[model samples]
Target chain A: MALTRNESAPLFSSDTANTLRLIAYLALAIALMVIDHRNGWLVQVRYFASAAVEPMYRLAALPSRLARSAGDAMSDRARLNTRNAELERELLLAQARLNRLQSVRDQNERLQQLLEAQRSLDLGVQLARIIDVDTDPFRHRVTIDAGARQGVAVGEAVLDAHGVMGQIVEVLPNTSTVMLITDPAHALPVKSERTGLRAIARGNGALDSLELQNVPISADIKPGDMLVTSGLGGHFPAGFPVGTIGSIRNDASGMFAVATVTPSAALDRSGEVLILHNLPDPVGPPAPAPAEGPPAESAPANKAPNP
Target chain B: MNRLRANDWLFWGSIAACYLLQLMPLPQAMLPLKPWWLALVLMYWTLEAPDYVSLGRAFVLGLVGDVFSGDLLGEQALRLCVFCFILLRFRARLRFFPMWQQALAVLALLLNDRIVLLAIRAADGQLVPAASYWLAPFVGMLAWPWVFLLLDDARARLRVRDA
Candidate 1:
């Protein structure tokens, strides 16, 4: 009845073959990590792995989603009536705002044509619900229900009602991974709504604040200045609310100021997001190229000299 | 024949259950406390049933772990393979340790695993993780006695003699 290994001679030992195998596996692992980081040739492998693991996430999310639907079903009539009234009032307000926006949109289109700019059609978006959040402490990311199958491409801007959320970093078959604006690896092209002082906001691995580096202390930026996507780098569309400046700390060297900004979006919460499927203009006419923000680069611009 | 097959199915079934548990979401505050369920389970099998859980098997499962956790492909494979190697080397002594001592052994193993994780993360240019990231191994240590007891009870109740 004893279920132990019954070999008369112990089969477990520090054998040469095991050591060789260990060395081989370690080499393979390091090679894989290096290759995946630099070349990305193993993207197909990641896609396959993501497809395999997505079902597990779905299974895990099923319980909470079911409970939510159950709660929705069990809500009483009085609550429903109050909610309906609230929604109707909200709808009326939105419709009224839309009526005014219609005229502004038409006038903007006419102005865009006068500037001889490429089609400045409105940005389009698709809705997708977040399914799971990344558990790694170093990275801030989420998995959404939409992917390449839904024509959701990588680098597409994802958003919530509050502000620019992040971008689609990975596109799997049925689910895509989104890197949040708070991830240490992400940076956004933003400009001051007041003075158009362009700056790059890089996430510092802290959810509450992002650091705007290398802006000279004399730069025309201040606390409470709303930052909208300047559309300079063209990663995100123009005019999306990004964040508000929190504090400006003068560096010890006094060469530049580092300002921390709290993101406008409630990034820590899980909910539906709008994926900007089409950006309004892919390119702009050449000029002083002031219309061009920073070129799209993986890293934030280290320096932008003011003339 | 059918009765013998049930035991094999049960072993794989428990593995699948553990995999699912590893996938389960914990609240953000509790993230650092979530034990490495897969590593613990792998350790359990390597300790109790060395025949089925070989170094190669450990490597493959580690690869699966890398994929499941969305890490680089070989990261878990390397970690698991090294852990399995050590477990295999020490299985003769570990198989006979009392439950309390077994828990100590698990604590030691998990602490070592954390060092490996640190090394891997450092290679990836990540800064030192939050203090709580180191707490997971101790969490696994606390869960070990219960996990061992539960699995042993299931193994006994099933009345499946070892091959």
Candidate 2:
């Protein structure tokens, strides 16, 4: 306000003041960014600021939402009936598949009981619609309509109907930002379904692919091998599909192999996602006895056993 | 005093519109083509009304943008401060330039802003951006002329009504 008051005083002083202010603000910004990136202590500041702008996001999304509803309301009766029939058939098929899964899950529960293993938690999922996409071209993030008010918390894994999408990074009162598995900064622990080979799948900043890090040259990985969450990290539950290995090639170092993974989730297209809650802690305390059994059956009661 | 207040309302209102435009959803294919709407609008005000648009104000506006975008705090602030500083330094000459030349200058400024963004990304250890990453500055450059005329018309109308 003082600066505005003095606007017409003189030009010479203003120019010098401009440069001085630029330097001061630049220093402040750099410090804020360094502190923000390193420790994320500035999240509280962002949390409050984002709350103030929440209505702007809604306003921006208003037109598309209206148009979608209008289009839905205008659909003809015949087309609607066909869509209804198709959805009913799809629901029947899904119910059949769920019945099969129910039996398999029951069997698995029995097996876990026999082995005295902690049963996997029955996680809850809240459905949320994508409200906005990140403006930054490099970062793969999206804002969802559900947030802290809806019991959404930071670090909750998000998934579509098909597979794992990403994890919640920031939770506001009525909105949250989900960092997709394709963000260059994200890394997920995944295992091959066939070989149980564990590797860290790092996002390459591309929506279509992830890269498996530090795989050994002789690792039993092949193209098309399904990758699932290993549950080594307590953030995500086990047996959720992450991606499929696309290609494997030796790294330039020749000692390790790098493989690209095609993410199973429709990262760019999915509008609705389920935010998982109450994830099971699969990585229990270290085992006591060194069992000389096969790795497949060795960690039954200890770390996460195959689903 | 009433006239000044009205002009001030226009100034802040236009800036708010720019923020809305930035936040508006675009198809994934059209995302890289979305020009830097905030920067373009800020450049207009900083040029036409230097008294109202200062470096400190620009920095704060960018901080707001950073918060809204969920980017690293102060990232946009630094970029916008540098942008405002440059525009202020060259404001006199830039004000006299023809429309086409001014658009070219806008292009250069937007490109410089991209470099600032690239430096920040590099410092943050982000992955190298894809080729489409370079397309936004050009889009901003092309959008500059229309944006300038539109805002200039709006300001002229505001001044006429105030008079």
Candidate 3:
């Protein structure tokens, strides 16, 4: 079975052509990464790759779907009946509450319209579906099925049923990735609903938890206090629920307090979200137009009286 | 030499098939168990046909893996090159080892590959501790025997058909 070196030489010798092909492949990969990171030249490539891989995901999930259906088919009739009865009871209670909320919402709408006359603000919203969770464990990000095609742009605010989730970071033709509020790199300006003290809320990458930075140890913040988006930054709108204060640990240095807040929105389990597209400017308001004419005769009369 | 040529095609084809399987979306529970099919394939070629595949191919395949997995550039490539170099240096002895010993060796190689990846991530200052991070190589080790047997059987059949 031992073959002479000459006889096996062709099988074992390093082929110059194959080596060149491999070197070419390596060079192409490096070039791709450079272009992708520096200039975003590979966005279309990533999009195409995602589209091509999506069908594979569907195909792989087929067995689980079959198993689930089989399990459902074999479920006991009595268990299904009991589950249905419980759901019906819960539905009735929810409907009763919803009826009361409907009337309250109508009254609020009228009040809001009256306020709008004083300062008109136009806003638009869109809905999107969650597609995938972040592949990197270090980042808290989710990919949504909506993308540039759906008018979802980077920096748009994403909100779930309860409150703000995060902002869109990357947008493709058919999908976009949202960097969730719980991402370690994310920070939002927040105001305590009770004290009106403004502080920055930063994500700790722990699901459902965030920390308020640089709050004075003696400040009037307590457990169970609510935090709302302060609208200091134009990134998010004002008055959206952010989180509730969980625990406060006053440092011996007394310079600051470490407070943990439970995020209002369920970051882990949400299936759908609303992308708020109409975010206002963060800096000073738009400048008013110059006087169109010389001082009017009634200008003095319209001016406020000196105390 | 003819027998070697037959195994080369069989092994390379199996590796391609494995890459396709890696693309298939398994259930969430099974996701962690999805083997490092590319690494297994690279290891096979490194051992069975070192002269043909060599260190450079392992490095290139690793780059392809990085692109497919959406990881940072050169992450998998560096790990695979190191793995292949080690395997290549000992290809002769590795080919003669018992099946169990070979699997153990592969497990060690994969563990080193993971460690190297973690080191790179740590250097970049992004660290997350999770048990699932180590799952891929263990699954790869478990799948090694089956992969080896299946490919070996196919190569034998192909050789007979060719003759």
Candidate 4:
């Protein structure tokens, strides 16, 4: 048998053709980027495409999944027993803490009833396991095994056991993409747990740091002050832990203060998360009290109905 | 001819492996250091068997890469297109270079890809990446020789010769 020689031809037939193809492909790519960045026009396209590719992601995740299970199975009995004991003790401690908070919650509810204020609604929460973390260095996103079919909607708040993790940004049929609070584009309205001074916490493209925007230098907030969602935007429920202020300094213009905050959530490591549902719409400025007898000022008297 | 029947299968299989390597979950600290495995593999095929790699293929693969990596839709597509176009232009010289020189050339190519990424990010109004962001190309450069040799061996075994 005659040996066949390897023949590796050039990819393009000619220089002109190469240049033309490159220009065309580049133009298409730029157009896609612009369309994707400008709006949600490509969201459906992405959803369908991701649905088709979901199996590939699962296959890629298989090794890690197997390893995790194998590690779980191979753990020594003594270590498991010790871990069980540790968890039991932690549960007991949490129960004790809950007992104290339970009375305070009851008193607060009673106070609300007496005042005739809108009853605080309890949002539903669902647990989702993080299936994959984005490999792109610039993006801090993860794919959770919950999606539209599971009634996971965009904009739902996600949290780990410790604090707010992020919000759902896109939902495919079987999986959803969650944008971490540490993403550069994300911002959360938060208030100082110590002083109640409201501020916006903006992600600075780092997993460990969030910058509080437009903070006042004279504000009572300081290092170590805990921040919690203010529920002003209605995206996140009120009082969820966000982060702790790390350092504060005046900006370049000295017009406003900037405080760097270390996020409280495990932005890099959480394997499981809780997604909050049934968040109420932004309850626009509270209706003026009827007792004040200012009937003319309360133009929009009808309260927005809660779903 | 009978042996070459599996050529297409092997080619796609290699591409699949590269994608898996790229999408495999990595620790946060190691993410920036993850080399562009798909690029390296594509470069090898383009140099050794350009019949299997083309500009269109590169663009399509990059688009899929973007989806898998969760980047802006066309970001990786553009990056891979530029990468492939450059590789095609210099294939004659690059194919004949000694292993070390070829590795350096690959480094330059990966560095160019990084610059393209930087421009894309800048256009998207993202902040400048950290210094560690530039580290992946060096890692890719170091891995180039081994990748080339490995794929070369695989190609020879698969008998991907001209008809």
lDDT of 4 at A139: 77
**Candidate 4 C-alpha lDDT tens digits along B101-132:** 98999899999999999998999988888899
- Segments of candidate 4 deviating more than 4 angstroms: A1-17, A71-82, A97-122, A280-307, B160-163
- Tens digits of lDDT, candidate 3, A77-185: 9999998999788778666656565565567557767767313223446778765433444467776778888888889888775667999887766667788898877
Model 2 Cα lDDT, one tens digit per residue, B1-163: 6667777888888888888888877777888888888899888877777777778888899999988888899999999999888888887778789988998999899989988999998999877788888889899989999989998898788778878
The order by descending TM-score is 4, 2, 1, 3
For candidate 4, the lDDT comes to: 0.79
Query: Which of the two, 2 or 4, has more lDDT?
Result: 2
User: Which clashing pairs does model 3 show?
Assistant: none
DockQ, all candidates in order: 0.46, 0.55, 0.21, 0.52
The most accurate candidate by lDDT is 2
The numbered model that scores best in TM-score is 4
Model 2 Cα lDDT, one tens digit per residue, A1-307:
4345535533343473367788899999999999999999888887777657788888877776777789899989999999999988887877766666667667866786787754332345677889865556668888899988899999998887667899999988899989999899999999999999999999997789999979998889999999988877767767778999999998998889999999998898737777877544347763422111121232122221111
Error of 3 at A116 (Å): 7.9
Give lDDT per model, in order.
0.75, 0.80, 0.67, 0.79
Taking the tens digit of each residue's C-alpha lDDT, what string does model 1 give over A1-307? 3244335334444452277788787788788888877877676887877767788778766766777689899999999999999988877876666656666556755776788764333344678888854535457788899988898988998888678899998888888889999888799999898999999999887777888999988998889999988887767867678899999998778899999999998787777887876543435554524233222220111101100
Candidate 2 vs candidate 3: the lDDT winner is 2
By TM-score, the better pick of 1 and 4 is 4
Per-residue error (Å), model 2, residue B93: 0.5
